[model samples]
Target: MSTVVETILSNHPQAKRDSLIPILQEVQEMEGFISREAIASIGKHLNLPTSKIYGVATFYNQFRFQNVGKYHVMVCRGTACHVKGSAKVLEAVKRELKIEPGTTSRDGLFSLEIVACMGACGLAPVISINGEFHAGVEPDKIKGILNAYRRKESENVK
Candidate 1:
């Protein structure tokens, strides 16, 4: 993990203020989430306080402080999606996974995120599991969708 962070910092020798977001994005991509160690290393590289780094990162919705679940579920709540009963769909997901938005399930199988838009309004009421779109989704369909993923993971475990 330190080596990965070191390599990322090395890429930005200057470590300008503007580089903070990019650095966080890259580190998150590599390590799944922002670690305290990464923040300290970034702070040292940028000559900024760790508080400042945390402040900046917390301001953005894109940065995640915790590791995501294996099945990262993003549910769209755009106008079209909402009009198509996405609220019900979202509720179904929460009920099925037993976790709210921005949180991973206790079993580490699912994480839920509410997005403003996914640009697939034509397929309103959409949810994506690890970027595999399940469009025109209804409340009843959520269980099957989740069960399919759970079954697939269980199969892999064996």
Candidate 2:
């Protein structure tokens, strides 16, 4: 009972069906996503089927199946951003990174996520990398921005 799952379950020693969401959240907080191991452990602890736990998790968008990359790219696609040509910006990013939203690149350099809004509509068509905002982004600017991050990453690795 000293496993990570047991530690998580210990918090809710008397957890019932309603305790599933909280348990999942704690696991995600600890592991960055709802892992297969966590799911199995949770199922065993709760005496519930793995399928049932998975079903509930998949029903929500809060769970992440994979870990985000070093530079997590969050592209805004809200109404303001969309009206400002965010689609083209998103496309440019996809082409540049060769990875779709909710996925990380093979080299572990980047990950993409589509966010509805970043609360900076005035800076529509914006993209944020590692919480740093780039305002008024255009498709043409995609390569330069990515290259900058790539250079920085390489330098950091040195």
Candidate 3:
């Protein structure tokens, strides 16, 4: 009965009621993560089963069940990046964030993920933060980049 659920259902009333995945994706993109209540509400709105909605959500890697951080970091693990020391870059990020891949920091300021490729092989060893790509990164620069994001976040909080 939330406004978000009503709005989404209104927009796609004629859509296949079972196609809740795309609706959930849009909700998550806007809200940063999907809550269980939202999922259930969506199911009710579509007149579909909650179990079916959950099944679709768990089936996709793109869907996140938990809240994500203010910043999401993706390190490319493609062949080109791997050859150019991507593993070291990933390790440095892990140390800086103190969280493994697919997890957000305790403060919800960062989430780290290992991606297959960012399609920037020409700029191997790339990392993306909130969709902003940084190319030709070295281990030494990793800390600085993370620090910069943290600084930006601090500024925003002020």
Best by TM-score: 2
lDDT of each: 0.92, 0.89, 0.86
Backbone clash count, each prediction separately? 0, 0, 0
lDDT tens string, model 2, 82-115?
9999999999999999998877899878989899
Q: In candidate 1, what residue range of length 10 has the lowest lDDT sum?
A: 58-67
Question: Candidate 1, residues 1-158: lDDT per residue as tens digits?
Answer: 48999999999998788899999999999988788999999999999899999999889877777779999999999999999999999999999999878778888889888999999999999999999999999999999999999999999999
Rank candidates, TM-score, best first.
2, 1, 3
Looking at model 3, residue 145 earns an lDDT score of 95
- On residues 1-158, what C-alpha lDDT tens digit does candidate 3 reach at each position? 66776687688876776568789977887766777888888887788888888788878767776677889999999999999999999999999899988678999899988899889999999999999999999999999999999898889889
As a TM-score, model 1 comes out at 0.83
lDDT of 1 at 83: 99
To one decimal, what is the Cα RMSD in angstroms of model 1 from the true structure?
2.2
- How well does model 2 score by local distance difference test? 0.89
Over 4 Å off, model 3: 14-17, 46-52, 100-102, 139-141, 152-158
